[model samples]
Target: MSEQALSRDRVIRTLPLTHWNQPHHDSGALASLEQGNVLFLPHLSFTLMPEELKLLDPALVAPKRKNITFDPQHNRVRGLARQQYAQQVTDLLSRYYQHCLQLIDALLPEYRHAVHSPSNTLRLHPVSTWRSKSSWRKDDSRLHVDAFPSRPIHGERILRIFNNINPHGENREWRVGEPFPVLAQRFMPHLSGYSPLSSWFQQRIGMTKSLRSRYDHMMLQLHDAMKADRKYQEQGPQVTLSLPPGSSWICFADQTPHAAMSGQFMLEQTFLLPVSAMLNPQNSPLAVLEKLMQQPLL
Candidate 1:
């Protein structure tokens, strides 16, 4: 591994992020995230009030990987929640979704961040209440970037908004790993080249979702590389953070290497931001990898 690759300054040139502790969103917030920084904000506490919580299905707070997912197309949330309480959950989710949408528009004026309609999947992860298994998809103990094998993101970025809603005053613990460029530098050379023929075959057989693009392929390879390396997992440079209840955060999960160490009762909203929204589109992972390889990536 090259020492230059591991240098923090050489990896990510991030802008200073402003913390939104109140009910306010700044346009700079979008730029900050585009620059690969995380912003912490005050949560929308009114969404899940105490009474609303009582009505929620036990599966939501249950010690497991159960959570209601909102379909943007159908405009509804589906989970193990009871039919009687379904309307309540649906109403809450509708408001919550609108709040997030307003937030993005307020913070990203002039920035062309087109969030695909109905692509947002809300997850209620009760990490503390659940037992974590070693399955690659289930285990978030190890630091890694957000990459989906079935969901080919192409060159688009994964912008995630997370809220720690632990009603009992519990905080979620997370470990932020090294910069994306640093990780890529360390793992890129070891990754095999993307095979177009294989991708076509997989897409033909329904093995790959929508056809795994080269960018997605590389991202998956990098994710696997970081997770498979035991030495890096134990001794990598990182910072641990405890996100308290009533707090929210925004980040490009694809760029930020993070690990869910502990804690639970978290609500997450996923969004896709286009490369054109960046202050400098060339700084994106797709462009960065292209520059590094001296060729087009996707």
Candidate 2:
């Protein structure tokens, strides 16, 4: 086989990406994201006011939590000073979350309706200091798609918006890996069948917020399997991108395999998009896995 053919056989999937230095809601950008590519906007930014910059301190992170977060659903703030500065922090994050939603609506108008009732939050990672102490499954430095063991999503797409807020002009380093289909094929066969009994037990015991579906079970398995594989973590087909301060990017975290190598003082929002809302539903992880396994996942 030729070198290129050999590389393909080895499971390396590489594709060109257009970095948006200027905002565009055109079909091309939407098409690229549907294909599981990152919509990196080099100039798209959320500017923090002078006084708001004081929230950058790492000391604000709550004990035992990796980052500070504001959950709009409950109007609560976690991992930050909750006594004197709670309201201030909450207001800042809430505004930022709404700002992210506005960008999504403008950039991907097709998804505007699907963005409702999203479990969105604002998270500030003070530093990469938690890396060494994190467990394998919790480690963000390993290439893995987003999945939640405690929350059962039932195959909803995980769209995330990230902004690097480092005041020092540092770049958030990330290693994004192969397409969802390619990564799934490598790990799906190894995943055992899901059990209804186990799902019920976990939900009843409060181990999971809700009953885990077959789709959720498979996704968690795939997520853990990918993170635990040291060889794949080191040698997987991937590309590293440095997101400089002030820049923001958006992607379907569930469809894109990525690892945060290093960064600090970043804000992010997570939006859940139902599979039915997708322009090209077949490109979703749920759809791709269903076709490969020859069964309905959700």
Please name the candidate that would achieve the greatest TM-score relative to the true structure: 2
Per-residue CA lDDT of candidate 2, range 117-212, in tens? 444443455336777878989988888999989999998989888888788988998877887888899998778899999999999999999999
Task: List lDDT for all candidates, in order.
Answer: 0.67, 0.78
TM per model? 0.83, 0.90
Residue ranges of candidate 1 with Cα displaced over 4 Å: 1-28, 42-46, 55-66, 81-84, 118-125, 128-131
User: Candidate 1 — number of clashing residue pairs?
Assistant: 1
Predicted candidate 1 versus true structure: per-residue lDDT over 1-298, tens digit per residue: 1232244432233333233222334555555666666666544443476677764234543243356767655876666345666666666666666666665655655442467643443345555434354565446777788888777878888877777766778877877777666668888887889999988988888877788888888888888888877777777876666777877777888988777877655667777777876777875888877877787877
Clashing pairs in 1: 72-118
Instruction: List candidate 2 stretches off by more than 4 Å.
Output: 1-23, 119-127
